[model samples]
Target: MAEIKKIGVFTSGGDAPGMNACIRAVVRTAIYMGKEVVGIQQGYQGMIDKKFVPMDARSVRNIIQMGGTVLKTARCMDFRTPEGRAFAYKNLKEEGIDALVPIGGDGTFTGAEFLSREFDIPVVCVPGTIDNDLYGSDYTLGYDTATNTVIDAIDKIRDTAASHDRLFFVEVMGRDSGCIALHAGIAGGAEAILLPEKETAIDELIEKLEQSAEKKTSSIVIIAEGDKNGGAYNVAKRVKEKFNFYDIKVTILGHLQRGGSPSSFDRVLGGRLGYAAVKSLLAGENRKMVGLRNNKVELTDLHEAIHNHTFKLEEDLLEMANILSI
Candidate 1:
């Protein structure tokens, strides 16, 4: 077993709900295990620049309900460069960092993997993306809270749509994957869902809306931000022009989905995953991510997990959305 003395933690990529809870868990749990915790600010950039603060139990005090990470986060454009990663390695060595815990999506994990390999430091990733697209885990830490947020927005939009017999085009964030859009669309009973993996035909969506209009039913379309054919704005305009559904409106959920108190599920999962991540480091695990699989927390090699694409909507849910809307 490796001698786990000082462990470093950072939140990377986009900020998501429940990031604070995860950071709190890691700091508190690592402190409980008699290890000094270091909080790296602004993700990988902090590590490259050697910017970090000592994290204690008091540092994470009363932050479990917070929306964003107290340590903050950022996108490190230099992480891919040899100079940047080497600088990070030099800093970690100088700081005597024994292990690393990164809370982030795929891009963040990729950076962690590089650092782990370059510096011979063990990294245990805690998946913390709203996209819920990380492989080997059924759910990411911030996904449930984000989904609930999106669903809440959709519910409100539906109320206005129903009252005025209007058609609403709601946009949610999901750049490389459509998990958020797919899950929220099914849960919110959206009339249509546009994902990035598949092409959305504007004509087909408009036709469906036209049919619904004939039947005196208002429609709500959910579009992932990464939709191939522009976004909700373009789709809504086309529908209005062709079918004259002048009551169309557009609501971009934007960062709203990324902020709020994490739901109970997220809090519990974050704690469990955070604790397991520390345990992995103590157990001499390196360059791996701790994930929940088949109702058990397990570890997977970060390299394989990053390269493997694993997010997709269930066919049953898609079919149900089609049936319910039709």
Candidate 2:
């Protein structure tokens, strides 16, 4: 490996809060280390298209508090092909981007792993997804903010539900993971939470709602989008078939969970991971990811981070959520 002179940073896959904060940290950290920084707009697609922009401390100023990403992001099917990666490598060489910091989820790290191995480019990743499903990090970049957003929505929905004596099925984003649904459900005081990690039968859910109906005039059920019983609409439909007392309403948070200013926790985590990513690349580490584990910055193999998913919903929290909801 050669000394990393300039680093390129990009965000990919779905956008998340605190990405700008991560970008700021990457830019400032690299500059502080006497390495130039190039912001790759739109992620791998930008690498292929040569969408490179020079970045300095001034360029990242006033962006840490902003939500979403300043460098932009996109899903690039072209990047999945070898030819596309070759073109991206050529572009990186042309732009003198000797190392890379990619902030994104599993899909993002998978791409980085391929590019780094194929082209021998030094690359590090920062987890920047709202799902918080990644393996290494205790919390991904936007999980806190997204959960807070869901809690706010749940609070408002609870007010309405109480007034109308309604049964609200609030769906939150978490297609493959239940991190968002579990955290937000517990925080929002949902009567029942359906997660993708747990196979929740509609009949069982109805049974729980039935119990809640006996004790309360209004109820809230948090459903992850990837729940086996389907989304909030389907769950609400099935529940309405049997447990039809209060007027049932469904609210899919959708991308609402992905936007808004990041909370202090997310901002700090983003900054830490980004700073560590630059430091790792400079330290000659490649195909790695910077993550916050047990409140400390740690490094994990990118392949392990992408392939071996160690993220698990805490059983104690699940048990508590069940007990408290009752």
Best by lDDT: 2
- Regions more than 4 Å wrong, model 1: none
TM-score of each model, paired residue for residue: 0.95, 0.99
Give lDDT tens digits, candidate 1, residues 117-141.
Answer: 7767889999998988888898888
- lDDT scores for all predictions? 0.87, 0.92
In angstroms, give how far residue 324 of model 2 lies from its true place. Answer: 0.5
Give every collision pair in model 2: none
Q: What's the distance in Å from true for residue 199, model 2?
A: 1.1
Q: List model 2 lDDT by residue over 1-326, tens digit each.
A: 89889999999999999999999999999999999999999999999888999999999999999999988899899999999999999999999999999999999999999999999999999999999999888999999999999999999999999999999999999999998899889989999999998998888888888888889999999999999997988888888878778899999889988999999999999899999999988888999989988999999999999999667899999999999998
lDDT of 1 at 319: 76
Clashes of each: 0, 0
Ten-residue region with minimum lDDT total, candidate 2 = 235-244
